[model samples]
Target: MPVESIHGRGATRNATPTRFNLQERMAEGDWLDQVEALDGVSSRRTSVTIEKPKSILTRNSSPDIGFDRSINAYRGCEHGCIYCFARPTHAYHDLSPGVDFESRLFVKPDAAKLLHSALSRPGYECAPIAMGTNTDPYQPIEETWQVTRSVIEVLLETRHPFTITTKSNRVLRELDLLVPAAKLGIASVAISVTSLDPKISRTMEPRAPSGRKRIEAIRLLNEAGVPCHVAIAPVVPQITDHELEHIVEAAVEAKAAGAFYLPVRLPHEVAPLFRAWLDEHFPDRAAKVMATIQSLRGGRDNDPNFFSRMRGQGPWADLLRTRFEKAVKRYGLRQTRFPLRRDLFTPPEGAQMRLF
Candidate 1:
């Protein structure tokens, strides 16, 4: 995602269409022509739409990510974290990845049905499924669609293993399923916390739950026997970077099983969006911040290389890594990952079961 605007949203900004739509996963951009406002001037409100996808399961063998298959219940995230690497994906829909990425959202209502169909295949292989890999599965719209919960119901019913990550405490709504799944060695959750500073969090993640709320969610999840960990993501250099140790400390206090951090990544549009954010919030240190980030990213806004993308390089990266390692050691937190059981998977198709 290339930078769209410093304005609020990761909001639906009207921008030129992107150059590629490889598999033709494209849609015409919509406009309301109704009244909305930005910069104290009028603008149009972004609209949400329902989309029916032909399939939901996405397979990625990238070494950087832990899972091979994943499902995203929603296309755009309302939690509008400006530095979201996934935001640029909205451009494929011929819309602005900026505002549209946040204001405009799309939900897959048939996610559960789709999953059932895929799992019913004769040679279907069972593996830990990752949810919210592209966008937060438990975003605000899930409040109404309940699509995420619907998908989880299918996973639980079929005895499938899955993991979900989110910054929203809304996850608790489905704890009934998560708790039992964990008991069966089939579920894990990671709550990403950027900063404990209320002011920084509110500005950077306008719609996400407060850091306090997310940490509490971890504490509660840990109590329920679910493996909950903390991800201090997009560690903004010179700004939120200082809170790296504090976030891990808080996660430990909340009984988080593990903690990790990823340096800010500005794949495409996110670079400019993040730059704008720094200029607005940390004007005095904006230049220094980007400089430090570039130094860590091989003198570029981002380093898309495989292993290094997750594990950064350079002096600043080394420092953050060292800090994270010491903090994890201090908290007695070994790798916080829990392997879900693939053997437990059961096909939902009655015909297959009847044949057995």
Candidate 2:
């Protein structure tokens, strides 16, 4: 069965059965019948589920990543970026890393409360807590749930240092909190702009804000006294790679503090899903794109090593790095890491009382 692109969605299929044995019934007679019934229909309404976890902060020791602690307000991202490395996470819930990862969503409503409790612990250590490390913190459902906003409120009240990375312009919604946090040198933001072309953005990140909107967001954030940067994450070869210099120039024009990028990565189930997406959207050069990506990943679909995963190893990777370095230098955009202050961190009122 050929995978056909769904309208307003990035993944062409609902279940990818091979990787994790998730949704293995797709080949069943009854399942095929059901799938056939919904072949051309594209109206996939998003469904939200509330999840109450005991804790909200996640601690990781990944050597490549900058931060040690992070918060993910939502489990499945509605942005529906076909190449999202986080999509495989949905398989843990017996859901498909394909369409289900975007449509069937889970939100941690108690995130703020849990974060407060964690911060109030007797031995709690203050570090920059990262948001949007896995799934986007400002994904569409955030408008109603406001979980991410609530988490930010807790962080602000406690005077904890934090950072946010998102592809949505929706981060501006919490400017009231962000502006104050930024003034204290405790907060910063990074907006991802994968491609300047609207057509490519629509198909690649179907539900994410357009590249134009993201660029405008960087401008607005910087003007508001917030240290903002541009992330050209997962620069798809044979697709959006041509716009590298153009994106860097745009970031400079927006007064971005710095800019960075990563070559496309396809880890776990994302590889097949991305392949299907390629066949659906860019059938013309899909093969070339994969070849380039494999070259960057050392002939594998993905490079899972520590430092190498962040920066690919090969001529293609070297070329991307050289181009990015020259562009940032030529455009005068600083490549320096955004400095966040941790000295100002203060325990929440409850924690302070407990100390006394």
Candidate 3:
């Protein structure tokens, strides 16, 4: 049977088995099967499950990534972006990395409390905490859950430095908290705009804010004295690659502090899911798109090396870098990194005192 694209959803199907081989297949009467049956008839409604984790802060020592620690208030994004690199994480829960990764969501209600506890530890070091690294902190469900907002509240109370990366304009809703934090040189935001065209954005990102809205968000954030940058992440080869110059120009017009981009990456189960998305939405150029991506990824679905993973190696990668550098220079947009201050960090009240 041909994989039918679900309405208002990015994944064409949800039965893509996880890479862990935890289960052979879905049971006959599983709710996922019911979802598959209602594909064309009705849209799949988003379902949120509350999660209480012991610790809210995640520490990573990857040399490529700038941040040393991060926090994810939610797992499994609802934005439904087909190229999301975080999709494979759903496999840990025995969930599909496809539609289930988007519709069946998880929110950490105790994130703020746990974060407060972590910051109060005597050995805790001050560093920028990155939000929306694994899942968007501002995904639609945030309106009700307010978990991300709660997490921010803790960060603000402790006077800790942090950064947020999201594609939704909803980050504007937190300007009340962000403004004061920015004044302290402890808060910054990066808005990801994958494509400028509404049609492409609708099918590609599905639930993310429109490109125009995101651009406006950049303007608003900068005007509010909060530093904002534009991120053209996962720039699709044949589909959205043509908009690189235009996107940079838009970022300049919006007064973005800086802009950066990365090529689409397909690792683990994401490879098959992305391929299915390409066939459903861009069948004509699917093969060409994969070909270009392989060339950028060194003839593989993905490059897992440290530096090379972040910065592709082949000629195509070089060309992308060259074009991006020229565009930033021509548009007069600074590509310089924005440094967040750690000196201003103050541990939460009741924190254990350190003795030299």
Candidate 4:
């Protein structure tokens, strides 16, 4: 079957008022002042459509990122985190990076096969393959598609090294595979926990596993002997920044081996999307939030300049770094600078190892 068939093709649109507009998936209706009027349409659950990806592995060579290559089992994420940097990726598929990014999802059933072929090639190099860097591999559709599981299966079978980053506790479902990989020093997991507040998490990352659940997942993974860490990432300045220490303390309590933190980044189309979300959710504090963000981002929406982008510049950035350092020191969180061994990698049958 063609890749398009494996990933569900675009649906034929019908002029039905009840049907959701997939193209504008994130557009929220007017705040309904009355409750009774929402009864007719509020109960309907949207049907998921699958889309097959032609290939899975995506490569990048940047000084800041640790991994050189990564794979995403799905195109758009259903997690619908308003602060997701990967949100803008949906625009490439002719969808809005906002609502369409969260609702009009795509799954690549062929991910395992494509990864196998890629790794089976003569030119293939052994590097930690990062998942969930762009989209959550274990999002809701994972229950049905199982593409992430299959991909992990391929990695485990070949004794391949990989790392996963995700916001879902669903990754616990694959501990059977990951635990073994960890034993071989071929795998590690990072759970992205944005905040401990349930109310904040509900609006910020609507469809992702709750923050508490993710912390529980970290504890579970660590108990199972899979190296796990908490990624206190994309720290929204005035919003979730205050919770940094709280997040680290919780992660350490949950037995996370180490912790890392990064400031909120709004590159490309993510800038506008983030602004819109801030406007919608925290209208009262939107300006203050953006102002704080600009304080770190060199007085702009984002800093796209290499080293500066990841860490940011100026006093606010320095303050955050200092705060993070102090928190990690107090919490005794482990360091993720744990390097994976690449010498054990062997080329697939009949393929020569890459010289590079």
Candidate 5:
């Protein structure tokens, strides 16, 4: 777990799959496999595979989740956030959730088409569809793939309401669409600012937009009449917990509409990957951080309880909430939700078709 080895990656190595797959690679017997893998087989090269999903919008009924429908243009994220809760999902694809989750990506190139098809369905509802809830819709590959932009185009044409939560400043590229959508009360964006410290951000997210860039993006988006909020996510105890107030202050300074924070949750394979990251970077304070995290989670790595999951119940959680509540009040960020236009929704086939 050398610093030099993990320079470009978030997790130093890929973890074993949690679920058994037909083809599994065991490093125990094959020294040649290790040799081949180490010899530049994965020297920071990105691999993008096409995912032909039958549908784009995914519906979830988790009580704690804010939105019911969402679209993830990509299966894995290149930003390489070590503590990402979505990492374990890679197991279903017969892939490792650690490094492989970041390197090997699956892009749904036909997402926009599928979304239109879903919207065309007779029983389709007009509720807002969220994007970037699972994987970031705007990643490095997005510049080339442009899948997210296409999806937005479809939404715009259909007059659909949607929200985007992302950590990438690259979302600025779609300002033309977002600016108009915001005016129509159809769109809003939230950016995650984990730490104001550039050093911590680099190690934590690896390839995500810098803290400064995300703050600036918020400022620009808000200036352009778009509702922009800040999310202080996965506030790692003993590591990033100290930066809570500072991040909120910076977000306010950046003109963020409002702000919210979530305590770090290490679910499934994410625990080991995050532990690996801790051992490599914050070795000195790893135990204390985990101990604090456990204290917040009822002596476990995670608390999957519905309401408490988003807002941990404890003194530490209380402190985080206090700081956030005070910060939002001090900044005078627009607390009232900038509601999206669900009523303005029109079917993909237009008014004449809706008349039927």
Candidate 6:
């Protein structure tokens, strides 16, 4: 049986259903049908329709996070990182936080324009507008949609401070804009490098670029005078922890100005998804990994408490911290945060309003 795609409805038959009611229901939008059918029973290949959202700035005040506002050009990432904390966000849109989270992606075509409008609004504050805090802004679709690039242009023109977090070298494509922004102290970038091992990276981040490429991205950004940082984030215990020092060393070699790390967070549906991935990839070591994770999570899959969530708890967590401190010192990685300037911010030039 050639299952073309995963149907959102109850069992979708690829071999033409015998039931007329099923076909009618599918046609009526009661279910989703992939537009393209592949020969193999792989993940669904559906046409991605664009949704022009009304607004783009997402404000937050979580003590665990650094930024006050963030923007995501796309909902649901193609990277398919099993440990993504953003997975639960898809559920708010009435979509499954699992397979649907990766397959059914939405692009905000109006993101750049909306961001510009938001920033230009009177009384708008000039805090760093975080990008890729949810789904990556430089994901594969960026090549076609160009929403992230346009948003960068808007930020650059207005001298707005912004920070980007991505695992793709595709960001290098926007160096022309980034270089100018960096010179003005209006921009910085952090590359998320999970594991140095390609095999582990493939399973951990599925469709994301290779770990080596991300290192190269950091180097390129630094060379262009853009402040580059390496985020050894969601550090999976027992699995990727050992590579923390190695990753930091590599980042140092690549000329990353600063470095940061976060213990793996398995909030919401991520816990089970991570477990499943572990079982599939490292069954023998699955128990040990979960045990260590639970220890960090205070005997739970996750600890939602403010500060503790960013960094974890227990002996393993302390060890990771010590390791990070040692590596940063050893590699001469800066502990100082990349502080974006607020004084440089200028409202978009236009005669649109004069209420101020």
The residue pairs in collision within model 3 are none
lDDT scores for all predictions? 0.81, 0.87, 0.87, 0.78, 0.83, 0.81
Q: How many clashing residue pairs are found in candidate 4? A: 6
Give per-residue CA lDDT, model 3, range 198-222, as digits (tens). Answer: 9999999999999999999999999
| lDDT, model 5, position 139 | 85
Candidate 2 per-residue lDDT over residues 233-282, each given as its tens digit = 97998899889999999999999988889887788889989999999889
Candidate 5 has a TM-score of 0.92
* Regions of model 5 farther than 4 Å from truth: 1-6, 21-23, 26-42, 334-338, 350-356
The local distance difference test score of model 4 is 0.78
Instruction: Using lDDT as the measure, name the better of candidate 2 and candidate 4.
Output: 2
What is the per-residue lDDT of model 6 for residues 215-330, given as tens digits with 9 covering 90 to 100?
A: 99999899989999999987998889989999999999999989999999988767776787788778999999999999998999999999999888999889999999999998
List the candidates' TM-scores in order: 0.90, 0.92, 0.93, 0.85, 0.92, 0.89
**TM-score of candidate 1 relative to the true fold:** 0.90
Poorly placed runs, candidate 6 (over 4 Å): 2-43, 351-356
Ordered list by TM-score, greatest first? 3, 2, 5, 1, 6, 4
Residue-level lDDT tens digits of model 4 in 182-226: 988989999999899988887788778889999999999999999
By the lDDT metric, which is better: model 1 or model 2?
Answer: 2
lDDT of 1 by residue, 1-356 (tens): 22223345533334444556434332333322312222333333445689999998999989888889999989988888878999888877766677678877888998888888888889998898999788999888888899888888888888899988899999988889999998988889999999999988777888899999999999999999999989888798888889988888899899997777788888977787788777767889889988998998899998999988877798988898888888788877665665678888888866333211
